[model samples]
Target: METAVIKTPIGYAEFKGDEQGLAAVKVLDTATVTVIPTVLQEAANQVLAYFEGSRTTFDLKLNPQGTAFQKKVWQALLKIPYGTTTSYLELSKTLGDVKAIRAVAAANGKNPLWIVVPCHRVIGSNGELTGYAGGLSRKKWLLDHESPVKQGKLF
Candidate 1:
């Protein structure tokens, strides 16, 4: 798989994929060399646009690797609109099994694609920010970034 690391406001983000589609997008602890490939440049650009608040939705080919159930959960995550949040219980209900809340949350936590899959949009039933592979601060930042209330322009 081809990989590229690009700088973002929160931190560096690494994108991995090939001609078929993007397999993963991860946030790194530190900045790395920007070696973006031609095939993945569009994905990189879309991520940049997201951070800039110029693009609310992504239009890139995705090929996230996961189990069948995980894939189903991830696909449901895509339905979450920008600037809105959903609880694990709500997500579970949407999946047709409120009893599977834990399983749905597990799949969400295991999502391989980061911002693209929008796992950050999932929250606790009490409206609290929950576990995030990228850290709570990053998750909060993502939510605030997408918030309709404009505190100020994010450059």
Candidate 2:
């Protein structure tokens, strides 16, 4: 799989994938740019556009590697609208199993596509930010980035 890194307002985005499609898109504290392969360039551009506030949805050929259950949870995450949020219980109900809240949270954490898959949209039952593989600060940044109200813009 080809790999590349690009800077973003929040951090450096590390992309990994090939002809099969993007397998992972992780954020790193620091990294330098590398030549993005032909296959990964379009996705990279779309990601940059998203961070720039020009794009709200992604349309890449995704090939995230995960279990069937995990994939199902990710599909639900995709359905979450750009500026909306959902809770684990709500997601579990959506998946047809309120009892699977823990399991659903597990699958949400394992989402490898980061912003491309939007695991950050999930929150605690009480409307609080919760566990995020990328950390809560980044999650807040993402949520704020998607917020439609633009009373402030900090660059």
- Per-residue lDDT for 34-143 in model 2, tens only? 99999999999999999998999999999999999999999999999999999999999999999999999999999999899999999999999999998999999999
RMSD of each: 2.3, 1.9
**Each candidate: what lDDT?**
0.95, 0.95
Error of 2 at 130 (Å): 0.2
TM-score of 1: 0.96
Please give, for residues 77-101, the per-residue lDDT of candidate 1 as tens digits.
9999999999999999999999999
Query: Against the hidden reference, what TM-scores do the models get?
Result: 0.96, 0.96
lDDT of candidate 2 at residue 132, scale 0 to 100: 94
